[model samples]
Target: MSIPTGTVTFLFTDIEGSTRMWERRREAMQEALKRHDTILRLTIESHRGYVFKTVGDAFCAAFTTATDALESAVEIQRKIDKTDWGEAPIRIRMGMHTGTAEERDGDYFGRAVNRVARLQSAGHGGQVLVSSSTQELLADNLPEHIVLKDLGSRRLKDLDRPEHIYQAQIGGKEEQFPQLKTLDIRPNNLPVQVTSFIGREKEIDEIHRLLNAARLLTINCPGGIGKTRISLHATTELLDIFHDGVWFIDLVPVSGKDGMWQAVAGALSIRSETGIPLDNTVIDRLKNKELLLILDNCEQLVLEAAETAGALLAGCPDIKILATSREALSIPGETVYQIQPLSVPSAAEETQGEKSCAAGISEYESVRLFIDRALQIRQTFVVTNENAPALAQICRWLDGIPLAIELAASRVKMFSLKELYERLGDRFEALNRGLRTAPPRQQTLRALIDWSYDLLDEEERELFMKLSVFTGGWALKAAEVICGSTAPLPVTAPPAWRDFIDPDHNYTYKTEGSIATYNDIKPDLDVIGLLERLVDKSLVIANQTDGSTRFVMLETVRQYGEQKLNDSGKSRETLKRHLHYFLLFVENYMTQVEDVTQNIWDTPIREEYPNIQTALKISLTEKEYYEYGVRIISSLFTYWQYHGSEMEARVWLEQFYPFPDYIQDPLTRTWITLMFGWILSSTLD
Candidate 1:
């Protein structure tokens, strides 16, 4: 590349309020440009200038002398001012700088070009600004003719030192004409501590890769899993790579569809002179610039945000967007990274001491974070030979989830690690005492989860509670059975209640303990609809894979749901119906070879076996067993035999063995006889 070694002045000019001029009164701006185009060309030519190109409504041009460039800029503004339409007048911003610029084939090139462009962008619309070099050159020649205000030195792109700038005044007053093109405004002072992202190196690396290549990258994870923190950290890491500074838009604060664009405009600090539409203007401004944008908390308004992001990506090739949410935006060229939870310590390793706990935790991110935070709270918190095992066991009990671990760790000031470990099962009772300072939503582990719970509808809340009957995980069909049992019937108290017990006694005694059977049940809800609503509300934790959706419940969530279910004002009959529904579902599964085999020992379901077993043990009354339990156990025989858990099957059958009605019925009797005989033979042999 040959370098040019002569005095050259680069001129960068922007059309102010171009979007408003084009969109609001497009015909008028087009007509004005047409009428003024000839005059504009002649003025530049007379000053020995050549128009390089136009950016939206802005234009770049070249001149050999700063004086000539300044004169051309003055005439263009003068001609536009002279040719005015009825409602809106034409306006523009012109910036000039004198520096030796290299000629690349036919186009102008060099750092001077970049400086002039940045300087032009700094000036408000309807103003002409020039660097000190150009101002001095003009002052030396025809200083008395044109008015100039010495604006102090300011920062521009790629320049360390502030450059001296002067704005030209027309007729001793600043022009009040509107800008024709939309201009870019940089948002100021982002949130502090974005780099405090505790873990997730692999996720951050994947996000960085996606942003570097894809037009859109979405970070998706469960609530309290730190998607927001990770995205912000990634943004902070990527700040240096983008020319235009990173823009952070917090979506959680925005309430409506229109508020999204307003938030974005506010973040960019856009102040339009004529109440311009910020959306179209923002798109146009970002089109030609290289920028990194972080849009946080997009799940609630995913469709709206996705539409906007898609438009931005299509319009702005140089722009990359990073969005964080509980789900994906699903836009084109979008890459999604699902963040996983932190590592939790294993039960055995933590039993020895802090050393073993720390060693186990070092293998997983979540457990490591828990240890680090817990240690901060208690200085004596060491992964010693003694505490290590207990810490590991505690982390395991908490599932190594960051939020749960954090809450668990916060109790160190008031509770010992051993106390926390022992009370892990009663999280609400244990963690509720500390952190009155935390937000109401995050005050306790239960409160944090309840926020998501409280957002559910009546049906969703009830279904979520009923789902807690399931231990760790369960099949969707099983949930449907459990929730659907008495949906078709209205709830009614047992006849014994109305006949023998008074209302006050029933309330008091019911709180003490209550029990009823399915024959007296009433169903008030549509089970299918309830399940759908619960799944929709996210009150039910669903695991969908390989074309099937499974659901499971956290113990804490289950307890919350059960409380809601009882409070839903249902009679004892509805509760019985709910229990019966689960029994009938298990029975249905026993009849189907495919159903029993498919989920008999698989994950999430396998985890819930204890709960299922307990439910079966308690709810499989003589009447329900004769009605439904016989069929389910028969279907499960194959599974039990394969897994060598014939003892569990036989033990469950012991409840039904005395219910001779089921054993006598051929349909139920045959499967029961076979399973019982098999278990007997296997044990005896």
Candidate 2:
């Protein structure tokens, strides 16, 4: 039979208490499951339903018509109730939803499939739940014995919008059951999110899994990584698990420990007693309640939050705490989960893979997130092979971070994709702004990074800027060798770091930090110990591959630090040191091969390719290092030839051509003339 293609009805079923039954009575449950499957399969098939998937006594079927789906669900429940199982009786919970869903390889997916699954979970055993769409379909044509009891608007778990549910009563008798398991049964203060939740399915699943094993699970990542949104979404999915409720407490305004306790109390509506303090009242109110507390933006008040979370958890055994911070709370029984950025397609995939076509490029999580937000701005915008590389480049340039991607996507309303990609070289101006309604720190990319940067001490800020001189990434040895210079820096921070409200009462931020207003302080730059600490603080990322770790910054972060270096009037000396290090790196001296050697390593050349390019650009363009720049280009000749960078090399060298007449150095002139001729010949060939 040809599979149902579009505008189909999905019927999802599960055996209530199936897991407990399997554990307690494996053999009996197995036999009961076989009988249950036979009843459902026969009834569904008899009603012209296509069973797409079955898992552990559950069935997900699709029907061409909503009437057929409704009839199948009602028939399956009746058949299961009357079946003769000696000891174990099987009760089936069913859900029916009708919407437009496209079939893929004999399976179905879309919001319809998801809605039906959520509907099925909201029903009790021996009952069938129907969505409003399905109910509207069967409005006049419900069989004589079947009637739908209208269950007015109820919010289903994991669904953003509320659903109008209906209970299908079969056999002409109204069976009494408990209330429909919906979100209204549990109270929550979870904020109503406006935009659609984008990628992070795996992260959300991992968060839930970790929460099941431990009470306190903290999602630690750099700022603007979407921790607050992901934590709220995860809590919404878990509404049915906790009886009391879930509460999202934003700690952005909280500065002290009392403010932290008061925030929780205010969220929970806990009133202070005569002698009991607000903190104690919070504990007393939550002592017996089984609830989830989401503490967001705790990095500012991390110590106070840690103390408050510790006290609350110790007071109540049933309460679980999920926190979002730049660093861990470091309390006992805390499961720290570092949420990484979304998956982005490599530059090679963007151009080389057949999958980079318009429809296929969205397979990358970061690209999908971008496309989702971009659609809101310009619905007609689409990705093609020609523009797919630019789209992939945008996501990669922003390091696959969600907030940065969203901000970049917002520019589709103003600029073309190519203009957006070209403007990303100045990361601050291109991706700095976000939705004005968002929190202060999140309103702009600059504000977000400033929150993390301002938290660093004098020494960390110095090393952070020094480390930015290396492109792509840097190893610990490179950071130690170059950043440990005993120079007392001019400033420890960017011009400004603001997380304040303006006169108009808008909760916005200002992070335009080319304004270099800092006190004169001498912070002895410490590299080795401080780099590790910065990694722990989420200001820096330590990527481990091939059994060796490389410390790196997000390109946005590097840009921020680079902006500071340029503003502080330190780029000449700092960039000179960077050029010298790579000069040795171009030779084999900087690597483990040791000794002053002329032979260059291809692997390091490729890994540090961006740094080499930056060095060449800076040295040749800057007046002080024209000779050294020419020397480095000569050194990279073999590396560039093998790398097929002939066109790129030609472009870089052409900028330095028609040599500066002030140069009287004969050897420099000789090497320059030969290099230009060689590149010109290579290009012609």
Candidate 3:
């Protein structure tokens, strides 16, 4: 008999109505069981997820991340649901608990596992229940949009105390977030589970479709939306696509750019001359082979990544790049797809009554993801009349972001649907407060972004603030004119000292001043260096690389940078300088865009699109720039529509309309009218 080696979280899933299904359609039921077994094993292996045994309709598995364990359970169910078994449908109820269990050389043994197995008996068909600890550990790393329905504390068999359980409700259909793993980013392959994936079916299908057509493709999405999960899933699917072998390059662990190249080179077992850069060596080796390359987490080091990817794309037509990022690398002929959140049941489907709930929205992937994840942890979980509205409200409150949903799901052990609803009502606040000691920035999603802001140096921080003045995406030249004219003052130095002399006693004193005092500061400004520092510190994410280095400001970082600008009492001047900068850049950007017009672009805007939009929106609405707003809009008409900036453009036009006639030129008036007409026409339908 084999003994289980390490302590693990046990997940036992039992198929409900198995006997009836077998009796009704023995042949179909057998086929369904075969499919179920395949999926259960495949999901476990995907996350390096582990399974102990399979007994008839029940499966015993384990995972390291409760989120992953929960996610694996959900994925298994989803696969089962999609399987065609002729007439025998299989619904499973899963129960999981995180605790130390002895893996006695293959056969597992422990009270934690035993308690969880016992809990399975209490579960109704298609439900999931988990211990409180499991919920807490996996909370932060979960996708942002899925909401967990807390079953609250429940008395279970063979346990002296009440166990807290949660059921997940995946909502916010069409919303997707980049799912974050542990921030350590070390190269260690820590065991994890594929907890839940919201949306991305279309993107996944498209990717697989392209897999047959092209050898390399990159999948990009914003942070905290399940990019790693999707990449891993794609790798699993591509196992068949690539008969040679499938491999993954976890870039998060490699500390430097060269290290990344070294990792890939080693993984592919490529040899090169002692002095040659590993990147070149690796490219040379891969140039002649067909391989599937899944580059996980490349948003932070886009330039290095782009260099490597471009080389590979050029040298090796057979190699494919499946990358996950908050932004995309605008390589020529590269296809960019945006992954969204799971769909929520429409309000019409949510009945209003004392026990009113939303049901029958199972067709939506968001709901399916939620119910499927919930059923993996709770024995009696359901999305019926009693909890539908609360569930729906939770999804909406989370902005339908998938990572947010998974985090909320982990809190299920602590609160009920109604209580969870109330807690989420203060999500902005709740998510910010750290329940335990963690990286101060990881306390909440907002704090994570805020932490990035706090790390920027004076100049980088200032540039971030000024850049926010842009209404939409701007060209590199625009950024250069706006932010490059004056370099940001360095935030740190060993106290620059100036020599002073006193003639009376031949005594000397040293005086120090801010970087602002240095005349050469502007001349010595290193924008690229500053950007590299910002990216390294995670204050800003370096996105794509073609000619311009694209980047993004986290919403939290934007807010914090704005606050810094305000506190410094430089808001007015900074805003003025920012406006001037854009004005200057617009002239140059127009030259670049003259051929394409405002509407047609074959590639995505630079990663700095969000920051630019934030800057522009603030200029028009929050800043006291009535006349300047119209001028800014007139300057960047092409940018407004180029970035899908419909709402912001409309608002700018509205703000421009009230300004005196002198401020609104014919170009501004015509653009505003056309934009307004577009908004009205689009909304009427």
Best by lDDT: 2
**Model 2: lDDT to the true structure:** 0.77
Give the per-residue lDDT of model 1 (tens digit) for 452-501: 77555666666666666555676655555456454443222221111123
Per-candidate Cα lDDT values, in order, are 0.63, 0.77, 0.58
User: Native-vs-model 3 lDDT?
Assistant: 0.58
- Deviation (Å) of 401 in candidate 1: 2.2
Q: How do the predictions measure up, each by TM-score?
A: 0.55, 0.77, 0.44
Which regions in candidate 1 have their CA more than 4 angstroms from the true location? 1-190, 194-196, 330-333, 345-358, 433-440, 454-466, 484-547, 553-559, 569-582, 585-611, 617-685
In TM-score terms, candidate 3 sits at: 0.44
- Model 2 clash tally? 0
lDDT of 3 by residue, 1-685 (tens): 1223445667888887787788788998888888888878888778556777776888888776677777777676567667776677777777878887654335454457656765664565656656677778667866675555666665443344556776654443332221111111122222233243345656677777776665446665444456667766555544434434556787766666777777777667776678887777777777777667777667666667777777778987777877665445657756655555556555665554532344345446555455544544553455666676777767655645555565565565556767878876557554554434433444566665554455456787766765554443344454555565656432222222233333433222232333222223343356666656655444455557566655665443444566666777767766655554443333334434433333424424343344344446545654344444554455454455445655766666665565445443454445445546655554443
Error of 2 at 319 (Å): 2.4
Q: How well does candidate 3 score on lDDT at residue 106?
A: 53
